[model samples]
Target chain A: MDIPTYADVEAAHARIALHIHRTPILTSSFINDLTGAELFFKCENFQKAGAFKARGASNAVFGLDEKMAKVGVATHSSGNHALSLSYAAGKRGIPVTVVMPRTAPEPKKAAVRGYGGHIVECEPSTSSREAVFAEVVAETGAEFVHPYNDPRVIAGQGTCSKEMVEDLGELDAVVAPIGGGGMVSGCCLTLSTIAPKTKIYAAEPKNADDAYRSFKAGRIIADDAPQTVADGLKVPLKELTWHFVSKHVEDIFTATEEEIVAAMRLIWERMKIVMEPSSAVPLAAILKNKELFAGKRVGVIVTGGNVDLGKLPWAQS
Target chain B: MDIPTYADVEAAHARIALHIHRTPILTSSFINDLTGAELFFKCENFQKAGAFKARGASNAVFGLDEKMAKVGVATHSSGNHALSLSYAAGKRGIPVTVVMPRTAPEPKKAAVRGYGGHIVECEPSTSSREAVFAEVVAETGAEFVHPYNDPRVIAGQGTCSKEMVEDLGELDAVVAPIGGGGMVSGCCLTLSTIAPKTKIYAAEPKNADDAYRSFKAGRIIADDAPQTVADGLKVPLKELTWHFVSKHVEDIFTATEEEIVAAMRLIWERMKIVMEPSSAVPLAAILKNKELFAGKRVGVIVTGGNVDLGKLPWAQS
Candidate 1:
């Protein structure tokens, strides 16, 4: 299997430049004061569909050949990727279908429908989601776009870090949340090529620390059950993503659920940006390991801002 | 009294350009579809201390002469303005004393202390705040900076629209929340001069629609036992603000408490930004009166994003 390189990421950036938003780099003195680290936040929360998934989805949809494109595309995601794929396909006037778990947030489901994607509801379990998605692909003959396991998808997600590095100059390290490891894997590849000395790290919720364990054990590790406020990080890493992460990623760190909630509230209160728990993972890691990052220049990719306002964790607290 | 003309606002823009953030202009296709208006959101939520109050505070702090600067500044505010003044004054190596209502959010009081401001808490009444602030000014000889009723502060707030107009270019109309009318008054002066044809409207909360009623009465009016989710709009309009607003403002619109909550939720969900209820007032008006802005280039000032996360009004629903 061919892997995505920095060149592929650069090409993907060129392809998606016009379609995606060049999200701004945000910095907060309050955050810097607390961590004693100069942090640059690559705000993909402002990206289309309010997440970085839009980059990969747009790249995948636009990369299809005329023959493949005629059949449209399908994906199984209960998160940002599903909405992003639906949005990209709708923009191109292509028929799209989304297989989502029944337990997904109503806002995410509404967003998919709002973007004109056909919805297939499956039982709120990984086995059910995969089984239902297989049926969706077979019935419609639609191209299956893997959320984070595909090289093209990883290459597209790399564009976020490329834009960050270009805008903010060289950084000592780049950190992003890890779920299926697509964003971090792509970030590692891009950073390794352009800023070879820069360390790349993945932040995962402690409740869903499969990636952290896998990184330490030098093998894939799966979590039977995950409970994290960062719903986006519940999935275990895939084979293709694991390959990139094992090769290029320097470390994977885990943040407790409390840390995640605190980070999310800090961003909301101090930075005045709506960041979901997943996006807060990078900041949470930095805060939890402040000693390591003190006085260092760090770049953190805030992945998404698709949060349920009424059910905010802080609100419950 | 020398009223701030368009020329004064233009000069103020140059004076405080270095100190204040040139906040970004945000556009959303989803928001456009919801409101049926091409909207440009002037994101003052990203400004220092998470509000446009930073613009006025920076201007006031920097505009002070060396002799008066030695004494520093003092203000009475229950929210963003207090924090903004503290931040601005602290940056200038000047002492600041903030007289806040005892009922102000604990987080806001903490923010004032975090920014190195001396806080004096009084009862949650205007008379109590005034009395406490007067005592503080008398004891410290600090310059009293009224949040909105001051000319210098109004000119400073005007810079927000100045930057917006420069970035967006020739908007058909401008909508901003009216709370003591500082921001709207300044906006009216600036827009009436630069984009003379651009209509200016003030969005007021239905519970605290003093400006709306005052405009209708052709005189300043006060609300009795005003109630609104927009905590910032509780203050009654003063003489200077009323004068500018009455002369230049084209119309005033009111948003219900329900509409304000819904608009706040929409901004959080769709725009992925943390907007306080006061900030959502303009959006609430646009969402309510879609026909008035159909096909027109509309500019809305998102005043601030300092909502207390723990006490979010929509949490119950």
Candidate 2:
């Protein structure tokens, strides 16, 4: 497998430049005071389709050559990736099909359809989803745009940290939530080359700490299905992402579900930005283990902002 | 009583430029498509202290003469103004005394105290608040900075639209929620002189539609007490605001409480930015009266993002 490099990230940035929003980096003095470190938040929550996935999705959809572009792309995700891929394909004016679980939120389904994505629903179980997705890909011959593991998608996510450095200059550390490890690996890929001194940290929920365990064990530790309030971080790390994590990641921190929710609430209250529970893990990790980041300038990649307002974890679950 | 002029706004902008955030304007294609008009949201929710009141509060605090500044400022707001004034006072390193109702949200009181402001509690009644506020002023000799009715405050608020027009070039109409009308008056102060072609519109909650009634009756109509999900807009328009609303405002539109909550939820979910119910009034108004804004490039002032996350208007009210 060809690993995505700085050059691939640069190419991805150029390709997705027009398709995705160059989201702004935001700062909260209150959060800075709370964390004892000045933090620059790369606000991917404000990206097109309301997440950083848009960057990777746009790169994948737009990078396809004329012949492949006609066939379009396909993905199986019940979350931001599905909406992001649909948004990218919609922008490119191409056909994109998303295989989603039948038990997925109705609003998520409507959002995908709203972006002109054709939905193929399967049983809520992972095996059923994988089986149905394979059938769809076999019939359509659409390029499979994996959410995080693919070189192209990882390269696209790298552009986020690239912009962060370009906009905010040097940083002592970069922290992001790790689920499938796409965003975290992207950070590692960029910082390992450009800002070699800047440490890369991956934050995960304690309930789904496969990445943490993998990093400690120096190997890939996949989980069957770990449940957490951070619904986005359930996926295990893939080979491509694990390569970057094992090589470049300084440490992996795990936050409790309550800690994640509390951090999310504090951010919404003080920073006044709406972000999902997954995005709060980094802050939770920092707050829980503050001594490491004290008085340093840190770059925090706020992953996404798609949450069910009617069923906020703190409120309902 | 002096009416704040365009020059006063310019002076206020210069004074508060260093202290306040030149918050970015956010656009949502989803909202744009839904409303049938292009909208530029002047994101004052991102302002220092999390509201446009920061502009005016900073102006008042920083504009103070050194001798007068020693005594600091006082106000009787249990809302964003209280926090904003405290934030400005904290910046200036001066004393800020806020007369808040004892029945106010503990989190709000904590926020006020967090900014190093002295809180003087009064009975949960306007009469008691005014009486206690007067006592605090009399005892401390602190300058009273009225939330919206003052020239300095209005001038400070004007900078929002000033920056909006500077950033977005031209807007066909500008819509803002009106309570005491600091933000709307500010828009009037700036756009009426500079961007004269931009028609000014104010949105009010039907539950507290004194401004709407005042606009229709061509007089200042003060309400004793009114309730709405938009807590910031329950206050009636004062004389300084009425001057602007009567002279420059083209029309005032009202949205029901349910509409206000729905609009707030939509903005939080789709825009992925947290703004208070008061800020949603403009969008609710636009959605309710869509044709007026259809095809027009309009500016919507998102006033604040300070809300009780635990008791969201949609989730509870």
Question: For model 1, how does the per-residue alpha-carbon lDDT over A149-218 read when each residue is reduced to its tens digit?
Answer: 8888999998988888899777998889999898998888788888887889899999999999999999
- On residues B1-317, what C-alpha lDDT tens digit does candidate 2 reach at each position? 78989999999988988899999999998899999999999998898888999999999889899999998899988588999999999999999999987866677788889999999898765677788898899999999999999999999999999999899987899999999888999999899999999999999999999999988998988786577888888777888888888999999999999999899988998999989999999999999989999999999999998887878877764
Docking class of 1: high
Q: Which regions in candidate 1 have their CA more than 4 angstroms from the true location?
A: none
Top lDDT model: 2
**What's the C-alpha lDDT at position A76 in model 2?**
86
Global lDDT of model 1? 0.88
Instruction: State the lDDT at A10 in candidate 2.
Output: 96
Candidate 2 docking classification: high
- Candidate lDDT values, in order: 0.88, 0.90
TM-score, predicted candidate 1 vs. hidden true structure: 0.97
At residue A32, give the lDDT of candidate 1. 95
Question: Which stretches of model 2 miss by more than 4 angstroms?
Answer: A123-126, B123-125
